[model samples]
Target chain A: MAHFEKASSITEWLDQRLAITTVKKVMALEYWIPKNINFLWAMGMVLAFTFALLTISGIFLLMYYQPNVDTAFDSVNYTIMSEVGFGWLWRHIHGVAASVVFLIIYIHMFTGIYYGSYKKGREMIWLSGMLLFVVFSAEAFSGYMLPWGQMSYWAGMVITNLFEGFSPDIAGGIMNAPGLVEWIRGDYVPGQAFLSRFFMLHVLLLPLVIIGLIGLHFAALRIPHVNNQDGEEFDYHEAAKLYKEGKTKESKVIPFQPVFLSKDVFVLGVYLIFFFYLVFYHFNFAMDPVNFDPADGLKTPAHIYPEWYFLWSYEILRPFPKDPGLIAFGFAQVAFFLLPFLDKSDTVAPANRRGLFKYWFWIMIVDMIVLTVMGKLPPQGIWNHIGLVAAVVFIALFVSLPWVTKNENRA
Target chain B: MKNELKILGVVVIFTAILYWGVEPFAHTQMHKHVDGEHFAYSDLNESTKKGNVENGKTLVMGAGACTGCHGIQAVAHKAPMDAATAVSAYGVNPPDLSTAGGLYSEKFLANLIENPAHALKVEHKFDAAKGKMHPMPAFYGAGGDKAQEIADMVAFLKSIAPKEISPKNAYLDACGRCHANRYGKLDQLGETPTFKSETDTLKHKVAVLEYQDKLKAYMGKLPPDLSIIIRARSEHFLETFVENPQSQLEGTSMPRVGLSAEGFEKVKAYLTQTGDPSKTAREAIGPWVLLFTLVFTVLAYLWKKSMWKDH
Candidate 1:
């Protein structure tokens, strides 16, 4: 939070001109982070690294990837896999990184919630992150559609058709475009226009939004020092005081560089090794095999599941009818933003936080995992009931947070 | 959050050890039963011992199971009864062998003729009628000149009726046995194929489903259409694997019909035509992929170290 240190002449000059010192103090090497916050704090750094990797790999893939319905699958199979040198490597990295990045983000989000980083001062962080999650999901769905494979085709059909509830044709055709779904798709079914639009959204439009949001998210995070596990030193006044004074020996918080940067870089190295293992050794682990076949609207696969990261939500999507399910899904994320407000727990540290919150928190985690597993199975027979129950419990965990906080005793 | 960095470091070390540990195990486990002594196509001397197609046509017409279940060229007094009535008497319903030559590899056919259950990897479960477990009896040594006769049979199948003779050939060569070929245009069964779309493949599925009696006659255990089988089994395993059931999978009832080494080659040629014909190309491309990955890993490691040094 140090704006100026009266150190270097170049820095001083830049500060006089454009307040580079202020910028540096806010987010750069001069930014101060809590020294006690360990590797758990590095989750954001890890996510940023993976996002950069995904973006780079995705750019390389975009160079050769054809977003035409006719050539999409073949372009991936022949041009990308065989014709272009190391194109397969880049494609694998992009696809695997896309799935892996969600995993890292979920863990990162969990860490945010586990500590009370999302509470009060950091509510904007949670809201922006949730918005980013929705945008990224849209990006993923669009990217998936660009492939024009079987799952991609059906997924495009199923998700796009959710908009049918709002379409004039579904109602009584009172006003606008009678076939809005067909108009958006540009055909009776998913075809060239769908691929083109999805490609544009996946590569161009959504990334800009994500980049903008990330800037704001990081900026917001900088204002509030990271919450530690045992959470004690939470003082906005102290942060302002430290910002006024360049150096503080008494405060335990350290600068971003040297202390945190080394640990972040080290964790990133380990993460990359696992990344390569998935890309090289388990290339098809995250993908559905039916994607190899080209799209045929006449035929559908026996089971159609979204990527695993979306499984928990997809599980929630089951058991209810489409219209309400869509609304439920929308409300679910909207409810997520209210979590910080719902959690009326006193202490910032989960360790000292009294009540049934810790137990409830664990139940939600296990519930999500259970729902994820159930999503992969067919939504029939016993699974219908399981999904219904899990979905109820999932919503209950978040919705009843305020009530749970009121009723529960101190831990 | 406390001692978590040390925990992460320890996890990384263990992961690295585990990562390095898995390569050799993967290499060994990739093809677990790669028996060295097994016969390959290279072992057979096909030049001097060319399979006589003429002799094969004769054996196929007159052989015990050949004439009984299979009708190759012509003259088959339809088995006194279809498989259903016969299964009651013999506990097995044999499949039509019109496309047998194209469906099975020469080695597979030879092994099957010599030792049916062993070749097909099944057991002689006498109680089960018209079941997969019912034994297929050995046919190679049944006659006076059984060995040579089997070779000729295999040659006839391989050369004359390949699973897919060419992209232009009719798709019927393999599937025509169990499934009927019902094209609206007659005499087009032998005509050149020009499939610009999946409609051609879809037509095959419809034609196969048209034979309700054929499917029902096998009782509950319908032999899966051979159209997809070639894609499932490989050549080398099908070669050394044809003669003995115990060498590979045990407990299944496909009887042996012995064929000589030359006959085995013919069958291998026939079945492999449909299944994994691009195997050589896939194998050729594999090494380059491995090399690229290994080289990039080293480069990534060096770059990672350099990036972290400043941090």
Candidate 2:
């Protein structure tokens, strides 16, 4: 142990024991941020805000939500929406946050890729962020099942069936895909067992995991610091020292507090305006119309599609025959995590400064949008061909990344 | 700054394309728009346009005999039988007609008065395949063939109806007997009755179940609750389907309840209220919330500028 100073006040007393002053210094006040970053850097804070909103609203919803199959639909549609005061407001906030968080995640993700934030020493940041993304996806999927509605039932059915891809022939016996599905569902179909388990995962297990992963995600950021738009590397310690010495204009970095937080607050204010607009007036996109119908095992809806966030991968899985589609989907899910290794370019700069990488980035984005659009459409006629082409392009783009970036030089 | 503009431009273009593909383009591909003209009851519309309300009232009270099973609450025209007796006889309670004028289309009412089976589009139930007759008989006893008399009856119902009926009242009067509004706290028989005793509650429960069973048998399936129907269906589809059930779903058990355009609007409002009750408050508070955020953003921008002024 080191020598301790005598405490003078409550904060001082607490700091003597808990290192409160050190924590505040390390986490916020003395934390250095690149001054060259733009509004996109604020997305991380926005996502944290959204997660807080989701957790709070989810707790409120859990108070009224019944997990039993017989009563779950009515509990959500009637009891929560009609009976509970401000229940609809909580629901709207939860719903819009759930959806809009994904939009921000995608933007945050692409921003990282464009700025080469996942390269060199920043791999852990990318890896931890991807882990958080996966956990968030699981949280969203499990929460979706709580409604016990037509879309909920069918989407659950379709997604769980993906486990079937694991079953393979072995020694004159077929592995039971159906049996695995039954074990996961706790029945042959989605019912009381499915509902209860998903409810537990959504409310308790997954949320705890998400909170833990979020901490890790931020922790991973501390070591590498944040990447700048220009991808210009400099000594952060020297820049921070210069900022401290009142040479703020000469310094390339600024303290995270006051300076960085001001810009973040401005971005958050803008983001909230967009978010509340959706929450209040245009929430239909977040809550599917077909989901209003109670779950029926026998009656399948005319069209079934996952939420928009998952559409790009869903489209990738759609056009190909089962096994091939499954393989492609598996690839798409893990592809982003492999970005650090796949982009062979030595330079760490914005895509605009990289020759072929710029085109690659833009094409990847357009291809993803195309896949998402095709995913929602009925896979027939012209749409089938378009989806097939888009899916092919998606896989081809990932496969070509290494070759495209290998010979590229910083512009 | 140039890079920010470039990013913004890209984002705007990308979002616009995505919206077009998802909303308008996807919609056209998924649902084929049904033409309302195909289901329009032209002759009935013409007759109702020139109906005599006084003559309609006399016919309903005397010869039309609508008062035999149905009650017009606004005029104190009670049904001849009690609800229990009516349920046993017709397998469903006859809805009150106090708001029928505001709840149903004139054409639908005129057609229903003339031929319940034909107007409701449940002709399949009475055909040789099913070998069953509708509980409500055709109005053959009094000017049933005369379209003018049927139109007059509709006009009378309309005349007696309250000018400004609530959405809940409109839904209960028009559809409550056959369909439940579960989210709105209504059973198949409108409001769930509160009984003073456990036995009375038990009796009500049994009656409701029995009524639902009878309805299932009569129509091949119990009607779905209308709590979320507004969200589940598009306005055009609902309008066309209400006008004539067979036009959208061939051989659907649902009758063409023929709501006049105004009645459909009220029913839709009720459904929307139940399905998305927070819509009103959400929309009302949206502008203020946006304004507050805008002001905060401006203030934040100014603070950011001031903080960076030294740098």
Candidate 3:
């Protein structure tokens, strides 16, 4: 791509010094994405839009949301809902988007799994994306608690209480000191300090970190080049060089602008339709009824269910009583962070190769859905047993992925 | 490629319009309310004045004419005029008030009785059908003498409840009529109580509706589950609201639940406990399932093994 060609005076001035146009020409206009990607490829764009919407809406909501034990619940219920001109819309977007972003990221994760995008050189991309997911979850959980509703207060207490697992009781001797939960909560329970700290993480800290990670994720994806269905690398710079040398057919890449950009926008429009539909029509669809009730430290909601996205791990948290269950819960998330290393198939695509891996992957999805449903269902009777099997299968799928992939038939 | 940018540009503009224009419009369309349109559960403060339960029963049963509409087993006053008859004059049936103190937050109940139409419109987003205001007439006017009468009525309504009624049954009887009960669907190992008479059967039918199914939203507000009301609102505030709600929030539709001070105590306890009826059961289930999952891991490991033959 030729830069500074028939440039306007302003473009020439900027390009002559800062090279702003030059950077855009390289990264934006001339950037090449693989031509043979699907609607799944548009997920990155949807995530970016969701993240942006969350930030924008979150900022507006923060203007109204009072981060105090006294005011947090009502700020959302009254001030945000009735006081602010369009506070309801923004609050709903931020609140509902918490679940939607996770929904998008889950699909994004499954897409990675389906195409094996996490394998080989793209490990950093996968790692950062997984980090985003993990951190994003922390962000959502913290924000969910900020409303200081019954669920928020209880969930905040329940989650912070998970740190109690660190305090091991051996022969009646405690290993870790007490108040680990208090330390995180900044009090005996979720109160003033919990709300303040969560407000910071939800709006500022976690988002900033995620923004940095998303940059790294995009950088890693672009640098080694985008992974595709075939699992073969096609370097855009090399392809560009070949095209300049009249070996254009060998260069199977198109500039991201017109090709990927349009698809991403189209996808963004489609994504926003569903996203705003939740915000507008089904705004409370993802919200639990208990959250509408104000927070009460003395009372815990009968079933301490996390939002739907966290249900997979929450289900995994169940069935392992005490320290063992806590350990299993901790290890469940560790599976995703360890996924790239756990899955070592030389063949990238799970299309035909990864036979056993594919079978188990669907089972994993089914298992996760069951686990999610079980998480919402009161833990009793046959449901508990069903949840138990689902949890075992959940961990088993990840545990056996590497070995299963090794044994799977190759393409 | 040029066409692609055009499409992208169009999409970007379309989504922008949808976000700024369509969504907010739709949201505003559905909900037309002002800031502080309704009070937060926590914002309400309870009155410290001790209510007299004896005074409450006298006000309700003696001169209040409360039995003209509401049914109270404790008072042995089942109004001769049923809902069907009342609809001709009142525009809506006066709901059975047997468990009024039990179901409603005291403050909500107080507001409703003091100003029937206003309380429902504000707190519950209640709308009177056919342009008629709420069926319940305002018993306590703005006159100075009305305070004791209002308090006495609330206290009297409060006195009708069974002490330590299981939170689940309380919800079924009081709140189950309007808000949906998620717990009602849970498979109960316990036996249903047997009702002996025609009146008992009707009450049982209404209770069953609340056992687990959801009620339609009143106006825009989902007649909210009282399961968490105790945790949601303080007992004092709950009772104070029921004593005379219009004093705190004008234009609330919830009729004052005419419960005595003793009745208020019993109902408040019941509403709060419903927040976590299965607390112990849920927590206990966690450990047993964990043990089962560990045992099942062996079976799952074998199942994974069977999926492979050569290796």
Give the runs in model 3 whose Cα sits over 4 Å from its true position: A1-8, A171-175, A235-238, A241-251, A408-411, B1-311
User: How close to the true structure is residue A203 of candidate 3, measured as C-alpha lDDT?
Assistant: 81
lDDT of 3 by residue, A1-411 (tens): 545556579878777768898798788767877765666778888888888888899889888888988987767766676557767667767878877787678778877877788877788988988888889888888888888888898888778878875435654546455767788888887778878998888888888898898888888877667777566676667876764565545666656755467656655655665665566556544666668777877667666777877877898988777766876797898888887888767767854456777787767766777777677666778878988998988888888777887764354
Between candidates 1 and 3, the one scoring higher on DockQ is: 1
Candidate ordering by lDDT (highest first): 2, 3, 1
Task: State the lDDT of candidate 1 residue by residue for A140-240, as single tens digits.
Answer: 88888866778899988887776655334544754334577887888878888888888899999999999999987887776666677676665645753
Q: For model 3, how does the per-residue alpha-carbon lDDT over B59-140 read when each residue is reduced to its tens digit?
A: 6666546777766765567865653355344433455666776656676566566776554544344454545545566775
* TM-scores for the candidates: 0.63, 0.93, 0.60
Highest lDDT: which candidate? 2
Better of 2 and 3 by lDDT: 2
Error of 2 at A306 (Å): 0.7
Candidate 2 chain B, poorest ten consecutive residues by summed lDDT: B39-48
lDDT of 2 by residue, B1-311 (tens): 68776886777688778767876788789876678954457634345256789988988888448887888879987877766677778877787888888767666777788778777777786653476778787776463547777777888988998989898888887788888877787988669988899999999888788888878876678889888888777778877887777878888887777777777788788888987777787778789888998899899989998988887
Local distance difference test, per candidate?
0.62, 0.85, 0.65
* Native interface contact recovery, all models: 0.02, 0.83, 0.03
lDDT of 1 at B188: 15
Model 1 TM-score is 0.63
